[model samples]
Target: MVYRGPYRVRVEEKPDPRIEHPNDAVVRVARAAICGSDLHLYHGMMPDTRVGHTFGHEFIGVVEEVGSSVQNLQVGDKVMVPFNIFCGSCFFCARGLFSNCHNVNPNATAVGAIYGYSHTTGGYDGGQAEMVRVPFADVGPSVIPDWLDDEDALLMTDALATAYFGAQLAEIREGDTVAVLGAGPIGLYAARSAWLMGAGRVVVIDQLPERLEKARTFAHAETINYNEVPDVVLEMKLQTDGLGFDAVIDAVGAEADGNLVQHLTSARFKLQGGSPIALNWAIDGARKGGVISVMGAYGPMFSAVKFGDALNKGLTLRMNQCPVKRQWPRLLEHIQNGYFKPSDIVTHRIPLEHIAEAYHLFSSKLDGCIKPVIIPDAS
Candidate 1:
């Protein structure tokens, strides 16, 4: 099946994918996920999607075949696919930055290209199909532990890595105060990561009560209902003893731009400057010398930033796609060592045939959707 355009899915009979390069391997996709990022691709919002591009990144599968040159992976191995495909020995990958690998996408300067995305990402097919062709197999796939279930390992590829990246960007430490700006799947994982990173308190902000409640129960984070509370920032300050959090992560991105920025900027700048409000809010939210890590996907465009304020306050801002290779080892350790349960973030599970229904439910916030993992072949 291929997506011709927004809201369109067509099943097409095609030759089974096989290893085209020595580094390539073929995998039978056992479990695949529909990431929030996939929503953009589904809605035709991605800039360069075409008719035949397969759509999906988060997937776990069994290695059905391996290329002759493949060294580590073997047939019958169960693996998790990294979102970004990269060569492990590339200049960037050597530095634990697989997201910017030089060899994965020779045509692009990015470290690596993602599967099932636009030409900007190498135009490689995705794992939404029954079988997927994995390029740079040694670098793209990670062997799953024999004891771990597929659902538990699914997030190790994307969301878990992203949440870990958020925590790393925050530079969190023991007793540090951290606040996550959303309670969605990513936000919940961010909260969990913050907790694992030894934050004394993890505060989650969102308008959804069910999500907030889940965060409070599973991630052990304090929850704030943005709607019920008249002033979210004030509530945060009150909880943190009038000093703002040491780290604030904007997981909500542009969707909750209005309130996200308000909570971020209301504490510092009293002047009503009409500058691009999102930037202002981000700047305002950070306490002096605080860290702001933005993991949300933003379009390729420029927004006004308060560089002067950031400089004066000594704030550190970091943003980018998650580097899976860098964080995979640690995340796997966390999962295997009994310190984290990333799978608990999944609130819904549906078969691939019901993908459209899943999309509707997730997009409409119905059925308590909070990261539904799509089982492509589940009967």
Candidate 2:
């Protein structure tokens, strides 16, 4: 897949990746996913998203080759690569902050390298193709458990992991009422994960009827169509007896609905980094001193946000590019226990050749595409 420009992506022939360094390996992609974050690149939201760039951060594959120094993996090993490209021994990685690895990205002070993202990350090609080069092979790629479904393993590379991380950041206590903004993939997973973390009630907010229904069925959470409610924040307060939710998760980033002015200024004009509507809603919809967990992707630009309101409310804000590998062990256990099934949310599986159509369907939010998996070889 090659990025032409905003809303322009197509399948293109590209050179198969090779081991460029002693620490690198090459993997034949078995499964790849179109993440909500990928839409940021598809829509020209991220800075330096170059033309001819492949746009995938969630993929699992079989190790096709390995460099001289790559010892942990061998050819034919099935692996699920974490979206974060990090060297395990870096200062941040030493503290288990793999997303901030200092050794991978030259812009390490900001965030670690990521596959198939723009030059703002590490400029590494992504795994949306038939093959991808795996850097720091021993650190980021985990061999997929034999029992794990391929579709499930693909989601763990980013979506499920990030959602699980978001829920963890919320610090949900037993019986706490949690509100999730957006009924997208991450929001859905965060809602389900909240239950595993002992949240008493989870409410998902979205304007789309299909997504709202998905929130109720897949996440097992109460649904609130913002379109139906006169005021979303007030409705949240009313649901929680006027005190507001104990915690809130802003799972909609950049492309959030509800506020036309913010959407136009941020998403349309590129005047701001990304929409802050969801973040602001999370702030106003939570109780005093309630925690806000943000898992949404935003560009590194100015976004008009309610900082003063957040500070005055004494809110605890936590966010990061998810350290995907860090959450796998617990998530794997959750999967084994049948508490979560990541594949349940997968609504479409389009081949790489039809990726343009996939992007169009997802971008338009048509055909109930909550999540779409990309099949590289299906064409």
Candidate 3:
């Protein structure tokens, strides 16, 4: 797929990738996902998103070729590639903070390298194609156990890891009440994982009926239709007995709805910055001294946040790009122990050829699409 322009993606043929460095590996992509973050690039909200770029950060594939320096992996190994690309020897990576690695992206001081995100994240071509070039192969790609389902492996590449990381950032205690904003894949996962982290009560708020239904059914969370409620913050406050939730998460990122003017300025006109409606709501909805975990994608520009309120309330704000490889051990155990099926959220399976249509359906929220995965060989 090639990004022709904003909202102009189409299937296009590109050259098969080759190893450019000794630490690089070429993988034959088996499955790739269109992440919510990709929509930011698709809509042209992210800067330096070139017209010919391919946008995808969640993918699982089989190793087709390995460079001389590749140590742990070999040909024919099935692997899940993380969204963040990092050099193992970097200062941040030395501290296990792989997402903040200072060596990969040209603009590393601003934003670390990420696959298929945009030029801001290192303009590496993504995995929404027949093959992809993976740098720092020994440290980034993790081999999937034979028992793990391919679709499950696909989700762990980004969505599941991100959700788990968000929950971890919240630092939920026993019997805590957690409120998650948005019912998208990550939101649903965060809501469900909150229960795993000992959240006694979980409430999910969203406008989409299907996603809210998913929150109720899949995450076992109390549903809040933000569209139906007069004041979502008031509703959340009422749910928590006028205090607010124990921990609130903002999974709805730059494109969140509710404020028409902010939407028009940030989302529509590309002025000001990304909308902080959900983040603001998370701030306002949390109880005093509650933790707020943000896993949403925001562009480099500034978004107006309720810093004064957060400061006054003494809320802990924790957020970062998920260190996907770091979460693998726990997530693997969770998957193996039947905590929750990561792939259960997949609502649509699409062929790579029809991704444009799939993107349309997903972006428009048509036909109950919760999560969509692209199969390279699907006909």
The TM-scores of all predictions, comma-separated, are 0.88, 0.96, 0.96
Question: Candidate 2: global Cα-lDDT?
Answer: 0.88
Candidate 2's TM-score: 0.96
Q: Which stretches in model 2 have alpha-carbon errors above 4 Å?
A: 256-264, 267-273, 300-303
CA RMSD per model (angstroms): 4.7, 2.4, 2.4
Clashing pairs in 2: none
- Clash pairs of candidate 1? 100-111, 101-111, 264-284, 264-285, 265-284, 265-285
The deviation in Å at residue 155 for candidate 1 is: 1.3
Q: Give residue 221's error in model 2 in angstroms.
A: 0.3
Score each candidate by Cα lDDT: 0.76, 0.88, 0.88
In candidate 3 the C-alpha lDDT for residue 310 amounts to 98
Q: Candidate 3 on 269-369: residue-level lDDT in tens?
A: 21122777788899999999999999998864355678999999999999999988899999999999999799999999999999899788787778998
Better of 1 and 3 by lDDT: 3
